[model samples]
Target: MTDKKTALVISAHAADFVWRAGGAIALHQELGYDVTVACLSFGERGESAKLWKQDGMTIERVKEARREEAQAAADALGVRDIRFLDLGDYPLRLDREAQDRVVDIIREVQPKWMMSHSKWDPYNTDHMNTTQFALECRMIAQAWGHNPGQKVLGAPQMYLFEPHQTEQMGWKPDTFLDITPVWEKKKAAIHCMQGQEHLWEFYTNVARNRANHFRRNSGGMAGGRKAEYAEGFESIFPQTVDELA
Candidate 1:
């Protein structure tokens, strides 16, 4: 296949991409990759506590606010396209229609690699549900018969971004991405999620902790490169390579 550097991120909620993989998106864009982010929901009902606390705040109003915030975050991350599916959240469910929509996006982008939530998340079922939706959509996107005459997707690696609580979610990171150069961009994206201010500090610390892991894995005290910030991912499929490093 010709190298047309492209990537896709399936975020369960509007701010999910920013917190989990903003740095990865920014770094990849710098490396000449066109990154697309698809947020399934605005997270207005479930994730927007601050906005809900407002007097007589409607779900539409909350969703509008979240959309604006997500757009700002996408700009900060240098995303090529940010698609908001606007499916309802809280009890995020993907029926046939929604699943087909996701499949359409996967086939349209035909990304070299994709990113989404971990396999499980008890704290928030939506997170896990979205991952399942991503997997199913990916499978459908690869089938030629799904929609004759349309482009089918190639087998692209799917990386699961770190969940909010790794231990609880059973997410183990096997890949560490050093995103020091784009740390500021990620930070700016993080700030855009003003509705969830508490997560700002939380995700920053997660990046710092991942940097420590990157240092150890890249090379210990022997000569590990210093990374101020990083992101962690768990690959769903084994990578194929001609030679092992």
Candidate 2:
């Protein structure tokens, strides 16, 4: 791996990182790589089910709670740079300006690897839209005239993460990352999302199952490792020797 390489995970909601790629973030940080999280929404709508059931749980209150949760999770993984785009929840809309903003962030961060939700997810409208925007922004950011600030950045490798309902959502995992050493850290990160405990549990199991799949593929190394966990991803661009080496 390259020194000072950065991994940027852009999500539709603040807590999406916890469910999708928390272990990957921890592993990157553990290996001395720079990791950043960019959230398009605070997840004010979808995550408020628990709090809304309680007394006085307004949308603003839910947003604040999610902010705190995301902060704590990021802190646990030693991540300092976190950005929330404040896009609407449920159905995330990315207009021209919103796309430009994403490009600008990519220009500034200049990450080597960028991860976002899979566009093929059928269940969540927000996830699919955000994924499409992220992919388009990545392309625009890499282009010469489209993003002037992106000059310093090499073309980034983009990966789409599995959604919560991978099988039901039709998310096919083409690549699996080993997160065995950072599984504990990933769990700790996930614990920060108090608003979505029920939802997070499902993802935790998904990670374990994906780890098992990797284990089987790796000739049982994944299963043999007790604390193993994995994140699945699908790549849009084919990785070349120059990108990896």
Candidate 3:
């Protein structure tokens, strides 16, 4: 077992982690956790509209650009590891082989916790599908019978990061994390995604708004902790604790 804590974030697209969980990633890294981000695809076919709009852009070129952007963002966030699965997107193909590959990653990381997209994303099936894939991979990692000799994974809380259009997606955030200390790190990472310039400010505003929720929930005006930025998440599993606060 490693001395340091670890975590894993399974992002559906190259930029998904930047938009949704950059704050969490940076904050965790700052707190001495080895955070690994696995991007299932570069979102080449479906999400690269601006790159595709360019006259001479080929699929390979778009993928290269997106991969660069993701790498830059990961660097900005101080990520310990960033893996690109290169699985084709626009309806991400998570075949049996893909599932086994992800299971291998899950066992390798042995994350204290895991993060992924919401359970429902009608606007983008890729996001929701990624969450389902995460669940399946987590299960496989825990099955000793499947991979005889490898270390069987322990129960790790799987956190679902906030998806776009929260209201429409039926994603209720049960956890609000104050990320004030690392907000700048997250902003820097967000800016690294030059391919999606429009979303830079959008996610910044999301952090600010989530901070408000954090404050209100922490304790209203009477005792709320002062926070400038935060992120929201929904846990897929019940947490076990010795005592309730």
* Ordering by TM-score: 3, 1, 2
Candidate with maximal lDDT: 1
Mark the regions of model 3 whose C-alpha exceeds 4 Å error after superposition.
none
Worst 10 residues of 1 by lDDT: 1-10
Worst 10 residues of 3 by lDDT: 1-10
Off by over 4 Å in 2: 1-3, 147-152, 221-227, 242-245
Summarize candidate 1's per-residue lDDT along 61-112 as a digit string, tens digits: 9999999999999999998699999989988878999998999989888999
Candidates in order, TM-scores: namely 0.98, 0.90, 0.98
Ranking by lDDT: 1, 3, 2
lDDT of 2: 0.82
lDDT of 2 by residue, 27-144 (tens): 8898887888999998888756887788967888888888899999998877878988888788777889889888888877789899998877677788888888888888787788
lDDT of 3 by residue, 111-139 (tens): 99999999999999999999999999999
